[model samples]
Target: MISGNKRTERFRDAVAGFEAAVRAQDADRSQQYFDDLRRYFGEADDQDFRQAGPRLAAILDEMPAAPRATVAVLVGACVERGADPTPCAPYVLAGLAGALDDARAFCDRWAATGGGDFPDPQAEEPPEDLLDRVDPDLAVAWLTLHHWEMAAVALLDHAAVRTALDDGTRTRLLRTLRSVEEDSGYVFKCLAYALLVLDDEPLVVLDRPTGTGYALRMTGIGDNFQLHTLLADVLIGGGHLPGRAPSAEEAAVCRDRPGQVDTIGSFNLVTPLGDWVWNEGTPSDIPVVDGVRLLVLDPPSYQRSWPAGRFFPHMKGDLVLERVLGADEARRLLAGCAAADG
Candidate 1:
């Protein structure tokens, strides 16, 4: 049996050989090296893959020209075997730069025919003909990455690639992706929310107490005023729902409740006296009740916010939320943000 160290060394050697072949633009030698890399990938345990993934990613980063077909195969294999696909993102994005026009055109045609919205590839399988209609290289990358929004989000990350496209083309692609993003029931929902909350903190309510809830302070990303967005963040980033497990820290802090806390389900923003500050359709000119002002954060959902409706799969019950920021507050916040920027 090959010792772990020896196997690791061989994997590194294969990566180096692959990089050298790519640098020299040698097709046959590249294939031979990639075969060895494939064998290593096939045999990699979790520890081995985590260690090797970064190295492979580093090589792909340096190689101006890579064997796109083999790279797709390797990335696809990584995702198929239940390993992280992050390392493959650079290569996927590189290929996507060339395929964006093709993807955008396909999406435009699909929308014209009333295809509606795109689904999360992880939670829901895409249509059989979907990949067939796209550029072959783009389809392969998506197939391996197991995401439709991957290309769109990847394009956003690569500013050079994104700006190279004509403004009209970029806008069309982004608009299509945004529509798909809104309807998705999984991680993409979190991503959409992140985009919405860019450069501004949103509110989030943590429902530990049964009657009154604890509102988390707006500090950083993932902490949003919207419960759905916060829940989406929890599900995507932590790989677990908030209701499923109570934090030991939360249990310690929530002393008013003797038993375990239930933090899931629909919530309402209320005052200290348990009066409705905001829930569902509360209307615009929300009066300052009892001399306290509320930080209103009612962003649009898959549908309008009212009477609590079901949208994402991660939710246990319906959610009824308040209205968006009022005109004065919006101006004040934006002005403050601008001043900070200046």
Candidate 2:
């Protein structure tokens, strides 16, 4: 049996060689290295895949044209190993639609077949709590659901991907996605919104940023670790609800019947837009001024917020970090701009 360190070392070496071959455009060498990488993936434990997945994905992104078969392999291995597919989502969206279908199929099969009925290692013959006996695969799948939400959001904002996909392709992809019944409906809504963007819904700047001392760049928004919490909250209809407080009767209904109605945070937007609600994790159909929209990432107690505001120029394919703007400057620039439609 290979020791964990030895296995990891071999996996890393294979990845490095594969990256070099791909960059050199040496088809035979790349294929050979890919075979080695696939073998490692097949033999990998959770820790091995977790460490290698992102590195492999980053390399794929830098390639001029990501190999579809290689993308499919990485996605399939992630599903089979119960790893998060987030890292590979860009490739999946960029025309390898079947990969997403295959991953979803694997997820569905796992759900139908026992869905993790492993015996509890620590418990007695018959475990009292079924939760304790859940197979790690199911737990990993549950965690991956969160990643799926982010992926869905990316699909919405990926303009380059939309340009590559025609109407028929978008429709087919949407149908494929709808065929799968997930554990939660939130991802479906997010995905539906993304599909809408692919069809005809023009991508617009959704918010106006406020707050001082914010810097901006053009890079992946996921790099902003601080906004993760806020983004998740907004995605799940958990953003601040302002206006008049809920009536006594409304409060009682929410308290007594929790699942029936969605709950929301009891705060107001720090950077309030005229009458816009920041519920959905999307930009509104606001008119873009000179191909630019304002995005603000304001944490509760601002410490060292770099991108407190971003000036996005009509992004279509890959999302980037645009230039930064001060709070006062951003507000001044966006003062006259209004939503194209409600």
Candidate 3:
């Protein structure tokens, strides 16, 4: 950890660089600064963040929205980064006050009830060279362990998700992998199947066999506010309604952006909250969905803000997504798979 004053300086530098990047209209630079800010919180002396985080959040929040990512990421980073230590829990919880009121309340409720750590286990070490050959669906779970933490700990006992996996036997999956992230076609497909089973909605993956344009067949639309964008990023990173999924670089572009949607990526999202927009390098204020599977995308890309409320898979926005499917299509695919198993 960087020592006291130096840690403070690092915190200031991150906020300063981000603010300057936004003011200068440097999209990429602002993104870099945001990434640095996240890193500072993680690496700076843990206690120093207790002082700098809220101040940094206030400063970032005051900046113009066009050049900066959302203030929530900055604030969320503070809470998550400081979460490792038991003593820092209250301080970290304090940082989540406004942006993650739901999460803060959860912390209170969970604490008052005498519990800690969500359903997800903290960390595990795997034997060397063991994780390399893990099944793709398992590989996806390992990746989720890194990105989303416990929110990715969906039940494996579910019949549909279990049936969807390539291997019925757990042999050869000896290692519990951590820190390795490789995209998997199986992970993409299985996540879709699992999500469809869980949502129990008529989900669909709006996509073509080739090229871009991806989203869900959404209904009973409501305000996306926070949950939709976070889910979109996680869904994409894990692979989504795959008309065409994002390449590695494209995923970075979407995750780093302040709002939902990226100029370069191929995916768009429609959530009950709102639609994921600005798809295929076009700025579309109003959505255009014509076909039965037509997509109306959401505009804000994924950022971390509501993890305390269990809103996203990752605390920060850096990972890539692929092999995607939307809700309606996911349901359809699962049905087919179930029939085949039967």
* Winning candidate number (lDDT): 2
lDDT of 2 by residue, 255-335 (tens): 222222222332222222434334233343222345543443322332221221111112221122223445566566456
Model 2 whole-model lDDT (C-alpha atoms)? 0.42
- Compared with the true structure, all predictions reach lDDT values of 0.40, 0.42, 0.35
Residue 281, candidate 3: Cα error in Å is 15
TM-score of each: 0.43, 0.30, 0.23
Q: Write the per-residue lDDT of candidate 1 for residues 16-134, one digit (tens) a residue.
A: 78878877878788788888887775456556555554455445534433244345445444443433445555555445443334444444555555565553334455677765555
| lDDT, candidate 3, 242-313, per-residue tens | 323334443343333333333233333442224443321111122333322233333324432321111122
Measured by C-alpha RMSD in angstroms, how accurate is candidate 2? 15.1
Candidate 1 vs candidate 2: the lDDT winner is: 2
Worst 10 residues of 1 by lDDT: 310-319
Model 1 ranges with Cα > 4 A deviation: 42-55, 58-101, 109-176, 179-266, 269-342
